[model samples]
Target: MFPIRDHNPSERTPYVTIGLIFANLVMFLLTMPWGLNAEGLWVYGALYAGAVTQGDMMWGLLTHMFLHAGLMHFAGNMLFLWIFGDNLEDQLGHLPFLGFYLICGLAAAAGQISAEPGSTIPMVGASGAIAGVMGGYLLLFPRARVDVLAIIVIIVKVFTLPAWVMLGVWFALQLMGGYTTPGDSGGVAYWAHSGGFVAGALLTLPVLLRKGGSRFWSRTDGHPPHDPIDYGHRSRVPQIPRR
Candidate 1:
């Protein structure tokens, strides 16, 4: 499901979120070439995927969050960040947002490494960290409406769903996938997705609590300060005659 923009709006642009997305894309492009496999494609995950077991390149725990394998990988990640990260930046401010994003990314890498303490495969991409942003979005704006583009077979549908349902389902899938496909050597670090999400949600708790917590939700009616906008359809399915 590709997320559509939220109906709620923020007072300020999510500058830090946009900058981080750009930074990740630029970093991936810069390092992607050097990490290509024999097939002349990028696969150098170790540059960011930590080698924690061997006690080396501890920095990859943080670096890995900015690295990605291909254009699709980078694009998908940045897209999500674009959709959901702004409100978070609005809440956390600039430096705090930067720190929060890094922490989530590093925590994501650490989760994958913990799952495969001795594996040599390098994990790459900003997905896990982005997952954190999604998690944080869930808490900050649970009632905010998200427009999702859903495609199946030859049919496409778009709708605005509650944030809890969208993110909740995504989080559930990660957990199931993590357990079902525990393949450290093969890539697709599901654990990182799972871990980063947990970290992001948990880490942001204190901030949520300080901001009047339940009271904030009560005051705002679980919505952001602005009203949602309707997204015109993105499809043109030909209408059929009445059967």
Candidate 2:
């Protein structure tokens, strides 16, 4: 299942979310035409991970977060970012929000690298960062409604669900996936997922603390200060018709 969007639109536009989606796309296109093969991807990964290259590319650890493996990888990351990032940016404002995202992503990589420091596999995708965004969303607005698209065979259904339930389930799956997997650096980076979430929650704690978090909850009543907007028309995930 994929989330098309949320039923509750933020009172403000999500500039960071849109920018992140475009940035990932542009980076992917830069690497895609080179075939993104083992050698190519490895090179990109090394450069992105800030490995000990002949020259300085130490910043790749941050840059690599924006690179993706393929269309689906990019799409999935973008979907979550789109669903969850805007509200975060809305709440945290621009620079701090960006900082939180990068910090969470780096923390995620730190966890993955700790698990596989010597492995020569290249990590790509904004999932770690996006997972962080999901993390923050769960904490800030647990009860907000998101539109989910569920598909089974030819049957398709769309519905609005509380953010806590959807994000909570996804977070649990990541934890489970992290435990069940073989800590395979070559496959899904479940550690990144597990780590990113922990980072996001921890990172957001400061803000919650400053705002008298429990008091903030009491003040805002666990939702945003603004009224929940209404959606006159339901949105469906735009299916890609196969050729």
Q: Could you estimate the TM-score for every candidate?
A: 0.86, 0.84
How far residue 49's Cα lies from its native spot in candidate 2, in Å, is 7.9
Candidate 1 off by > 4 Å? 31-50, 230-243
Largest TM-score belongs to which candidate? 1
C-alpha positional error of residue 88 in candidate 1 after TM-score superposition, expressed in Å: 0.3
Lowest-lDDT window of 10 residues in candidate 1?
36-45
| Segments in model 2 whose C-alpha atoms lie over 4 Å from true places | 34-42, 46-57, 234-243
Pick out the ten consecutive residues of candidate 2 with the lowest summed lDDT: 46-55
How far off is residue 140 in model 1, in Å? 1.4
lDDT of 1 by residue, 50-118 (tens): 357677777677666777777888888888888888888888888898899888988887788777777
- Overall lDDT per candidate, in order of appearance: 0.78, 0.77
